[model samples]
Target: MKYSLASGLQPPFTQRESFVRSHPDLYWRNKGIAAYEQNRATDAITAFRRAARYADKPSQAMIAQMLWVGDGVPMDRVMGYVWADLAAERGYPAFIATREKFWHELDRDEQRQAVVVGQAVFDEYGDEVAKKREDKALLLARRQITGSRTGHVGALIVSLRLPNGDFETVDGALYYADKYWKPEQYWEWQDSLFEKLPEGKVEVGPLQMPPKR
Candidate 1:
C-alpha cells in the first residue's frame, strides 16, 4: 500500500473543497461543471480539456459531448469520439452508447481516426487515471468519512463499510491500521477469520440528509 491515514472524522465539504483545489485535476473538474451549468460552454470545454489531462472521466465525457454537438467547442467529431470512447472505457456507460450511436453518423474516415485517437489517449492516460483513483481513495481514508465506524478482529481494529470509491468491501477496511494487526487479537468464533463488531452497521442506500443548519 502506498497510502495510509490516521482514523478521525472527516472535514466538512467546505474544507474538502479547499483540499481538492490544490489538486489541479479535481479543481478543473469543478470549474468545468460550474461553467457548464452556467451556460458558459466555451469555458466549460476549456476547463474540461485541462482536466482531461489528468484522466478525469467526467471531463472527458463532457468534452466529448460538447465537441460532438459543437455546443461550446468547434465540431471535431473525431476528437469527440475519442474522448467519448475513453470515458466509456473508464466506467461511464452512457458514453459507450453515445459512441455507438455515432457509428452511422460519422463517415468511415472519421470513425477510423477516432479509433486511432482513442487508442492513443488510452495508452497515454491510463496510468494517470489509475493514479487519480488511488489519490481519491487516500483522501477518503484520511478524512474518515462521517458515516464510517470502527471494527475489530480480536485485537486488530479497522474501519467498516468504507465508501465505495475507497473500499468496496461490505465487511470493513484495514486501510490505515497498524501493519502487524491481525484478527486473532480477540477470541474469535472462527480462528481463520475476522468479523464486524456487533454494534456496527452502515446505511448502504441514499443518505437521509441531516436537518439543515
Candidate 2:
C-alpha cells in the first residue's frame, strides 16, 4: 500500500511501522498524518510537533497549518507564522505559499514575535537540514562513483586490463578526497597526490578527469 498526505490516506499500519523503523525521522510525521486523518487532533499535534524537532519539513508545514486553523492546538497565528517560515526555509514547496500567506496577513507585532520564534527554530534545526542534505549528497556521490576510480590526480589517468586480454589506458578521478598541493613548477604540475590512495581491487572503466581550477 501507498501513503499520500495530500490524499489523506494512510498506508497500512505494518508498512508504516516498517518504514518508521528504518527511517525514524519519518516516524512522527507519518504518525501525525495518520492521526489527523482519523480525527485525532491532539495525537496528530503531538506527532507533528515531535517530527518538527527532527526537521521534518512536512510536519512543520502541517503544524503551521494546524496552528493557523486551531485544529488540534490553540489558534496562534504567530506560532503558525514561525513554523510556516521554518517549513518554507526547508524548501517544502507546499508551505511556501502558506509561509507567504502568514507573512502578508500578520501585523508588525505578530511578525516580530514570529521572527523571534522562527529564529529559535532555526537555531535549533538549521544544521539538521544542512547535515541531512550533505549526507544525502555524499551517499549519492559514492553510489555514482561506485566500482570506478572517478577522482584521481594528474588528469586521473588509469591503466586497466581489458576483457580482450589487453591493457587499456583511461582517465579517472579521486572519489571526493582531500588534496594538498603547491606549485611544483609554476603551475606545470597541475595535479599532485598529497594523500595515499586506498588499497583495493580497482575497477577499470570510463575515463574520468580532475576538476579544472
Candidate 3:
C-alpha cells in the first residue's frame, strides 16, 4: 500500500507545518527537487546531501547520479558508488540495480576506493545512523505537538481541520503517536509516498545534465 503522511485529512495546518519543519530530511528532499527542477544543480546537490542525513534513498540515488556524471560536483565514481550502495541498503530493486551498475563500471583501484570511502559514508548517512536522527526528530515533534513526552494524552480528543476546511475530532494520543510519532511506522508511511516503479529496466542515471551555472 502507498504511504502518505497526508493520506487522510491530517492535523491542523500549524501542526503539519511543525511536523514538516522537524523532519529536515523531507524538507531538504523537497528543496532538492525544486532546485533540480529550476536547473540549480549545485543547490540541488547540496539539498540532497542534507536529506541524505536521514537516509532519504531518492536523494541518495540522485547524489550518486550527479556525482558519477560530474554534473554539479566533480565526477567521483568512488563516492557515487558509495551513495548508490547506501541507497540500496533497504533492498529496493531499483536502487540495488543502480548500485550494481555503478560497481560494474569501477576499475580495481576505484572499487577499492569505494569500499574504503563507503565505510565513512555509511558511518555518517547509513540507515543505522540516519534512522536515529529521524527517530529523535520524530520524538521531538511528537512532544511538541502533544505536550507529552510519552505521546499519551489518554482519551483526549483533538480537533483537526482538514484541507477542505472541515474540522474532525480524533483520539489525540493514537492520532499523534501511531500516525506521526512512532519512527518505524512513520518511516513506513513516508516510504509509501515514493512512486511505484514498473517492472522493467530501471533507469539508473540522470535523464539529462543540469545546465551549467
Candidate 4:
C-alpha cells in the first residue's frame, strides 16, 4: 500500500472532495505532502499549518519533521523535538530514530519537555499513522491515469532549454517536426525519464526519447 511516484498510480482519494468529508487536518496533511513533493514550499507550509490544528499524534509527528529541517516549511527545531518526542512515546520507529539522531542538538530541559508532550500525543494518535499510510496508498491507486504520459519528447526539449540558463516560454508545450502538444518542465526531465525508464518495446523513464537527429 506504499504510495510512490514511480508506482504510476494516480492518487485514489480526491483531495477537495475527501477533505470535505474527512477531518480537515488530514486532508491538509496529504495536501502538504503533495506540495512538498512538487517543490511548492509556500503551499506546503499553508497545508501543514492547517494540519496542525486537528492533528493526531502521527500528524503531529509529521509536522515536527516539517519544522525541524524546514523541509517544506519554516525551521523550528524546538517544535520539531516536541513532535518527535510525542511520536517516540507512541513507539513510532521513525520518530524514535529522529530523536536519537538529533539528541545532542537540544538541551536537557527541551528534551524533557518533548518527552512529556510526546507521550500524551502518542497515547492519542499512535494508530492514526497506519491509517494515514492506508489513505496515501488509496490516493496513489486512484491517481493512476492510463495513457497519461509522464514523459513526452517535445515538452522535454523546452524544459532542456530553460535549465541550462536558456530563455524559453512559460508554456510547456513544445514543437517537434512542427506538431505542438502538451507542456513540460524541460528535456532534462525527459533525459532522466529515458535513462531510468522501464525496459519495454518502448521503455520510458529518464531518457526514453533522444532528441531528433
* TM-score for each predicted model, relative to the true structure: 0.52, 0.53, 0.73, 0.40
Model 2: lowest-lDDT 10 consecutive positions: 186-195
Give stretches of model 4 more than 4 Å off: 1-16, 72-74, 109-213
Q: Judged by lDDT, which candidate is best?
A: 3
Evaluated at residue 167, the lDDT of candidate 4 is 49
Candidate 3 Cα RMSD after full superposition onto the native fold (Å): 5.7
Segments of candidate 2 deviating more than 4 angstroms: 1-16, 127-213
Better of 1 and 2 by lDDT: 2
Please list the C-alpha lDDT of all candidates, in the order they appear: 0.52, 0.54, 0.74, 0.46
Candidate 1 lDDT, 83-185, residue by residue in tens:
7777655332344455566566789999888777777777755545544543554345434432334423233233333334452322224333322122222
Candidate 2 RMSD to the real structure: 18.6
Model number with the top TM-score: 3
Query: Per-residue alpha-carbon lDDT of model 2 for 1-213, expressed as tens digits?
Result: 121233223323213333243333367777887788778889988888776665566676777778876875799999888877876663333455567777889999998888777777777655455335434433444434443444224455445554457665543342122310111221121111111123664332221111212
Question: Order of all candidates by lDDT, from best down to worst?
Answer: 3, 2, 1, 4
User: Can you tell me which runs of candidate 3 are displaced by over 4 Å?
Assistant: 1-18, 153-179, 190-213
> What would the TM-score be for candidate 1 when compared with the true structure?
0.52
